[model samples]
Target: MCADYLLELASQLEFETVSACDTRDILEQLLESLAEHSAVTDIPVDEVVLANLHLALHQLDAIARGRGRPAINIPFHVIEGYLLHGFNVKEISELFGVTRQTIHRRMNDNGLRKSDVYSALTQEELDAVIGEIQQSHPHTGYRMMKSFLQARGLLVQTTRVRDSLRRIDPIGTEVRALANRTLRRRQYSVPAPNAMWHIDGNHKLIRWRFLVHGGIDGFSRLIVYLSAATNNRAATVLEAFIGAVNKYGLPSRVRSDKGGENMEVAQFMVESRGENRDSHITGRSVHNQRIERLWRDVYIQVLDQFHILFSNLEREGMLNPDDEGHLFALHWAFLPQLRRQLAFFMDAWNLHGLRTAGSQSPYQLWASSRHHEDPDQVEADYGIDWEGPYGFDDLGHQAGQVEVPQVQLQRHLTEEDMARLPDPNVHFMDAIDIYKATLQQLMQPRSEVDEGGSDA
Candidate 1:
């Protein structure tokens, strides 16, 4: 009776000749008609036979939809699991009793291709790992992300990491594209740690401007020092340079932009070397690309994060831009935090391994190179005094502040100190005059009383 019933249903639907696209619809119609017109007792329906018929229908539907070959009823999810577990199309075809073409077609149609570098984990597991990596290092690229994961004992391929990044952190993907677009193909190298150093300033903050003067060793990319100051004055630049020199002798050559802020430092370096041989003052900022690139990392790690917070606070009217005190107050609140964060970033950057540098950190590279150089020849070449604390009395004197040894160790100079610092050149003098004028304008009374009349 079940066979007779099935044959009757097939006759009504013409199942033998139905196109693939219309198979699912036709099958549904047949089932509905049978349910409506026949009773279970009349048809004597058997679950196994009905299931086989449904499987056949599904296979026909898949073939008609151009998803795979006809007469194969293996679920796409099962095939995906096989591919994910290191099974190839040929093996899967033999296992499923289907041709390799059918397996390939099904896999491609269902988006089950193993496009990533082989990882032993399931898709869900890989996604979870990628998500964790993105959360930890939001600005890191796929290569670095893969390294970080490998460090955690998960051997993931770079291609897989890139795919994960594309799915989970599209913004970072775009950021990477923009970063690469701006890259120049120039190559630079140095033989030793103190061969050359690059210095620059960053002004990415809104209300208050801060100086980020840092030096990167040309050979090892070791960060000599990263200092923040309230103003980008010549003295501020010198202070940062002195901080680096005090810790690790002088660089043979110092490089910086032609900005007036670096003029005095450049002069000092040339004076120390007793010639222009050690000073590289270029008009183009890109020539100091080493330090310029360092700023990009700081922008991602520090400036951009704080900018978002401070911007939100400003929009909410909690911070008053009109009040001069508000600026210094927030500076005091934020600059110390920024300094601490930058110190951490410096240590992490110096210690983190780089593939190009033979998988050694900048510090390791510098240390190894230092071991090879003769101490006397090195000291003579750079002419480093290597004596008592490198003096920054000039900064204090020029800024009209008492040279306090203890305060010198502090991260930032007081606003009063910055205000008293002598203007380096005509442009600085103009800025000072404008600032004074603005203050005077703000301090003037808004309303005046008449001499012979009551207050109006």
Candidate 2:
């Protein structure tokens, strides 16, 4: 929604949207916006609205305190990282868990200057670049195009991006722009980071006996866990669910589809959350927006490449779906590759800025929106000691690494395939190295492989 609309809503609600005192006011404003916009768009608030409204409501909260004293210093490297990532001082300050004045003071102290003019990129050069991007993402409008350009460190204006897109692909640009103008703001609500989680299984690779089960926090959109598994059995997904609960603790609610695999998790959520009806929600897979949304990212980032690789193997004389040997060979070769790729994707995803979350990375949002309960408060309220998660140190800072349990493929190994297949778990192996090693191993004649097994 625009400022005019927000102002109108606040006028109707009899509150000043500009000077919302605290998070409670933010929530009150958010609900007012939702109720007002529902009449027009019939949808919830979206990311852009979420981000802009938050920065607006919390503007006062982000003011520097102790005004007469020296500015609080921040590490130069962290500030540099934010600046290089194309974040302005205000957005960085909001997401950095600090006041805007502090960020400005630190920039001055560190002798750093962020330039608004991207002097090196000429309009003609940007037009050519955007034309190329349109060749792939034809449906991309100026807003998303701006994000794409920002990601490339261009830091161009939305109006400039619109000019480029309109010139490059006039029809597509007009259609998307019209849609944007007409679409109403939509948003989902969750109180805190662990307030609710949307969990689901991805069946894109199920044709090859591969399944991906994952969860995303509803509030921060943080990925709690993303796993590659050989099967979608109830026990398997339950183990993944339990593992996440062990890390982040029980969310106030768990949302998933009405599949058998989620039944156990649903029961666990119900039992864990005071046996309440609202603890676990079941519905069609399409309705689980948070986790369902992740499938697209996985496909674009990693899953599609693997799909092409396997499809090529099938097109050639190599892979036969009906053959056990070929399937087993693929399992031994590629599952590890898939797991590692997913891990990398997970990291990149968590760190990648979202236009929705006000340009904060998912991890950044999760960290900043963590539960407000102090240690003593948590003990008093829940009658249990809490120290965040296993990834946290004593000071409550998240450590760089947390031990992730190794995935144990549920596929049973016959004695023959075990003796015949070459090991691909080389130390310091990259995806290419793993693929090359496994393909070479798989190309060995079936007769030779059998003979090797017989010899063994």
Candidate 3:
């Protein structure tokens, strides 16, 4: 009766029951077939049913079909771990007592295979790859380095690259330090290149007091113009502003700090856009953080090194303090070199890839956003020579060459003026009293005096 029942059950389950000596053998074979079916269909068997199958197999001494229990009972995660470590299907099949086909199917289901687990690159090879990336981008952290490597068709894990960089790249340390010092203030967004402009001056070069005035586009951070002069006066600031406007059309708004040097620029902006519109002057420099942050980069890349060289030259007497000839030589010879270096720095800054901008250069970003800019906002005569006859040489006048109108002077001091002066030999308190009294006497109304004579 049991054999009949087993055969009927096997038929219902779509499997042919093998002939056996007793009910136990028949049950063991049936359980083995069920396990195989479960593995094939990837449907988990209930724990009560699985336990019953294992008991029936154990009773018949069939738990070890080839080497171990069926693959259906083993967890898929364990199999995946072995596969990731370079284990092949044949080996795994033997260990789990599963067919090669079953192992392969399970591996495919788990999204892994022998081919997916290649041998990791040697430490030396990883160092070489990291070194090359560091040479190009010294400030790149481990994650950026990984991106850079992948972009060049080299597949490497970020963890491995980071370990290799710590061992071989020393500049990575300084890069991290500078990165920490970077300001984290929020910045205003602009839709187009010429939407807004930020301008500021850097005066860190102490000995020469060279002021580097620069303007940058707020949207793209592209340096519009950079100039080095002896002072941060109104004329110097105006020249820089006009030069930038001539190159990149007028910005919708100009932003700067409320300093005397920027007064002329503020006036120009007011005159151009009308007083009802936005003013050029912002709050303090801390509020204008874009251009203020750029000053740090300029100091680190150019001004600091130049200051060191200048100090050494001065110590060696090549740059004299009192000699006017030496001063002229310093200005004519070294100043031009500094300006050339600044130009080179600006070129590199504009062309180099910025990680914040998706590895695009500032110039590239600005060029891409050009179409979105408003044509009406741009000044039509922006490129005109607005600085005509403004410089000293263009006005055809040398220093102190302008004539001054003459004014007549009093021939002598009156008695009241003489008495109001402080006595040289008096006590400090008495001198203060006499000075106050004399000031009061001078403040009183003065009697009329003839043009050719003293006061009566």
- Please write out the lDDT profile of model 2 over residues 1-456, one tens digit for every residue: 133345555564455444334444755666686668755655555433454455444443444242333334455676676565555788677765578888878888767777633435778998998886555345555655665565555667556877877777888777876876786544555567776788877666655667778888877777788899877777888888877765555677777766778888888877876553467776545456666556776676567767776777778877665555455567767788788767655655665667667767676677556634312112111211122112212234422222223334344445765554556564323443554555555566667766866887
Report clash pairs, candidate 1.
20-64, 399-421
Q: Tell me each candidate's TM-score.
A: 0.46, 0.53, 0.44
Those runs of model 2 whose alpha carbons end farther than 4 Å from true positions after fitting are 1-88, 91-98, 111-187, 242-250, 267-272, 351-364, 370-456
Model 3: per-residue Cα lDDT over 124-147, one tens digit each: 988887786455345556654554
Q: lDDT for every model?
A: 0.59, 0.62, 0.57
Off by over 4 Å in 3: 1-187, 317-325, 371-456
Candidate 2 local lDDT, residue 439: 51
lDDT of 1 by residue, 1-456 (tens): 233344555565465564545656766776666566447425433333344457768777676677785566566766664444334577567655679999878877776666642558776788897786455347877655664565454556557777888888898799998987786544455557776777766666624544556778877888888877677677877887876765566766776656777777788777765563545444345345666667777777557766776677678765555455445545545566667656656765665556666556676566546422322222222422122121111133211112111112112434643453333233311433434433333333333212212342
Best by TM-score: 2
Extract clashing residue pairs from model 2.
Answer: 44-186, 44-187, 45-186, 45-187, 46-186
Estimate the lDDT of model 3. Answer: 0.57
